[model samples]
Target: METLHEIPALRARLADWRDNGLRIGLVPTMGNLHDGHLALVEAARARADRVVATVFVNPLQFGPHEDLDSYPRTLNDDARRLSRCGCHLLFAPSEAAMYPHGRDAHTVVEVPGLSAQLCGASRPGHFRGVTTVVAKLFNLVQPDLAVFGQKDYQQLMLIRRMAADLCMDIEILGLPTVREPDGLAMSSRNGYLTPAERARAPALFRTLQELAAWVAAGTPPAQAERDAAQALSVAGFEPDYLSVRRRADLAPAGPQDTALVVLAAAHLGRARLIDNLELDRIVAEAH
Candidate 1:
């Protein structure tokens, strides 16, 4: 329930908890928390003795044309949600506090091959910003474990890689994606969907499901991707990329692979939505 805006004060609080042998869990967010975010909080609660959620809307991660100016910031509602979910501390720092004036040198973590595909292809330097800010928060919070939603699957992978590569002691957790009843993945960007577009948004997930079916049927990766792309167009989505890759390395799935992932991104009106599904289980069911 306690909200601390100052970094030193928050660090001191974490220090106090650690000094008393309490396990700390960190859930870093950009505010406007929803059930999906709370899912992360719940996961953290189950593992750690104390949980800290940082609600800073990081500017570094946003692009020039992105919705940084208009991204939702509902601290009161977010606090209430976190409180209901049993969060211990909320670090809601200002932009200046996060990125101080005269901040020059920056540390960038990139997961070489994975960062270059999917969302990274469209948004250059996006992951760098994300990694930088996240690294900063990790240092600031210094928790025993940190949790991120698997909705941003690539992001979760990159953070996991970065943390391991850098030898950070914190345990990185990837929680499953939380979605709306209509099958649309929950995101702050979902707020921008018009009523008409909102109705069509589930088409993205449906297309993903269809793609999963194709993969399950032992279809070729190229054929499945083409079918998924065509289905997405037919569903009224401005398809960005419909890709199939190994769940681990994110390299394209080959003919011999039993497990694969269908990752898709498209523009539903002005809002861009991303969704993915696993092909292994669906393929198993098909056989």
Candidate 2:
């Protein structure tokens, strides 16, 4: 696979594929790839004739206090993984290429109400940064299909909402969150965990599972959320948020809401991890 840095060079290669009438797929990422990211490439390859994966560490998406500087970058290994996995092209652009006029000067794209809720509420302007850079990627690649992991369920939903509202025709596909032998969600941030913290990481997913059980057993959503947060705290985590919400739009889940997802974000030492469990609507509404 060819790795191109400049936008024009990347566009030129895509044009040749377009000329051949080949369908295109996209998988975007911040470098430091793992098996979970490779799964996204595999998902895209299954749906399209050629896959275009992008590794751009979006400055827009990182809050000032977030780990933008310390975030891992393994471009060489990332390219190797993509090539071995059958990716057609890899676009790894520099910060300047993505934001020639600088991040502060670039136009922002916000998705109104949904952009400021849930995960958005904690990380102020985080989803705004996400939507803007993703909108920019959509404009640049114009791929027929784009694949993302459901691990960041809110992000998957946000990008879908943004594309639909903006009327972009690309298909947004969400694959299941890949996990280790233990239930902890696979993330680049998982690298930050100390040995002891890593051993404790699985508790986050277990807590989310317990929360889902409580809601399924006719418990109030708010009560279950509080119980889950307390459990995480007792397990040695600084809880961020653990709430039940309608998976469709992430509005707080009502008593009888059919489509539901239980999501959690919490701090464990230096690493902040997020994970979720999508509920069976039939089970959640049974009571």
Candidate 3:
């Protein structure tokens, strides 16, 4: 597999693939790949003739206090794994390659209301950074399709919105969240957890599972959210936002809404774990 570190080379290669009549798929990521990330590559290969995976630990997506400097970079190992998973090319661009004009002057792409709530409320300018960088990638590769994990449900939702709003003729495919046998959603940030914190981590998923039960049992989402936050505190977590929202637009789900999702984000030691569960599955399980 070829590894590229510049924009011109990436576009040149993509153009060659396009000329050869090969459909391309993109899987953008911040290295430290695990099974979940590899699963995205597998999904990409299934749908496109050539798969290009990028590893840019986007400084734009991180805040001043966030772990930008400390975020793990395992490009060599990541490339090996991606190649093993049938990825055709790996684009590992440097911060300068991505920012080009420096972050302050870089053009920003923000998705209005969707970028402001939930995780956005916790990390201001976070989604703006996400949308901006992703927009750049979409323009650079211009792949026929791109794949993302549903673990970052809100980010997935925002990306889907931005792509459509901008009319980028690319198909956005979201694969289901891959989890550990213990049920923890796989995240590169999960590496930050200490052994004991890791043991306690699954509680976040368990909490969402319980919240799904509450919603299925006719309990109001707001009430379930309040109770779940309290539960997280008892499980040794600094709760962020835990709520049930309409899956269609991520607005708060009212009683009449049958399609809903329970999403949660909380601090567990150094690792901030986020997870979600669909209400439809919960209702199905109940019956």
Candidate 4:
């Protein structure tokens, strides 16, 4: 696979591929790749003729007190993994190359209501950073399709919405969240978990699952959130938020729809973990 660090070089290679009738697929990541990221590449490869994975630890999305300074950047290992996955191109751009004059009069991309809730509430300008960087990557790569992990469900939804609203001529695909044997969602941030914290992390997923079961059994959404928050507290986590909302519009769950999602985020020591579970409509019937 060819590796290009500069945007122009990467765009030139992508142009050549387009001219040759090769369908381009792009996977944008913040480096520190794991199985979840590779899954995206595999999905991209399946959908298009050429796959390009861009690894830039974007600074725009990170808040002031966030882990941006310590965010893992395993470039060598990431490259090796992408190579094994048969990725055709890898674009790893520097912060300066990406921002040039540093976040100047750039047109910010924000998906109105969606960015103001859930992770949006906690991270402040997180989604703004996400949408802006993703827009930049889309413009730079110009792939026929882009693959994102469903683990960041809100982010994925916003990206899909942004692409559509902005008239981006590319398909946005969100693959399923990859998990560990113990049920913790696989994330690059998982690397920061201390040994003891890592062992306790799966409790987040367990709490989410238990709450989802309650919601499926006709429990009030508020009560379900309360119980999940308690479970997370009992598991030694500092509960950030535990909410049950209609998965379709991300609105609070109501009597009209049987399908719901139980989403939770918490502080397990210094690492902030997030997990969610979807309840199928048939789940209500079974209960």
Could you say which candidate leads in lDDT?
Answer: 3
Off by over 4 Å in 1: 102-105, 281-287
List residue ranges in candidate 3 displaced over 4 A.
281-287
| Model 1 poorest 10 in a row by lDDT | 101-110
Residues 1-287, candidate 2, lDDT per residue (tens digit)?
A: 99999999989988999999999999999989999999999999999999999999898988999999999999999999999999999999998999999989999999989878778999999999999999999999999999999999999999999999999999999999999999999999999999999999999999999999888887888999999999999999999899899987898997668779999999999899999998865543344
Off by over 4 Å in 2: 281-287
- What TM-score would each prediction reach against the true structure? 0.94, 0.97, 0.97, 0.96
Across residues 1-287, which tens digit of lDDT does each residue of candidate 3 receive? 99999999998999999999999999999999999999999999999999999999888889999999999989899999998999999999988998879999999999999999999999999999999989999999999999999999999999999999999999999999999999999999999999999999999999999998988898878899999999999999999999999999999987778888999999998898999998763333334
Candidates arranged by lDDT, highest first = 3, 2, 4, 1
Clashes of 2: 0
In candidate 3, position 124 carries an lDDT of 96
Write out the backbone clash pairs for model 4.
none
> Could you give the candidate ranking by TM-score, starting with the highest?
2, 3, 4, 1
lDDT of model 2, residue 157? 93
State the lDDT of candidate 1 residue by residue for 179-285, as single tens digits: 99988999888988899888989989888888888777778778988988998898888899998888977888876676778899898877889888876844334
- Candidate 4 local lDDT, residue 30: 89
Q: Worst 10-residue stretch by lDDT in candidate 2?
A: 278-287
Error of 2 at 153 (Å): 0.6
Residue 165 CA displacement from its true place in model 3, Å = 0.5
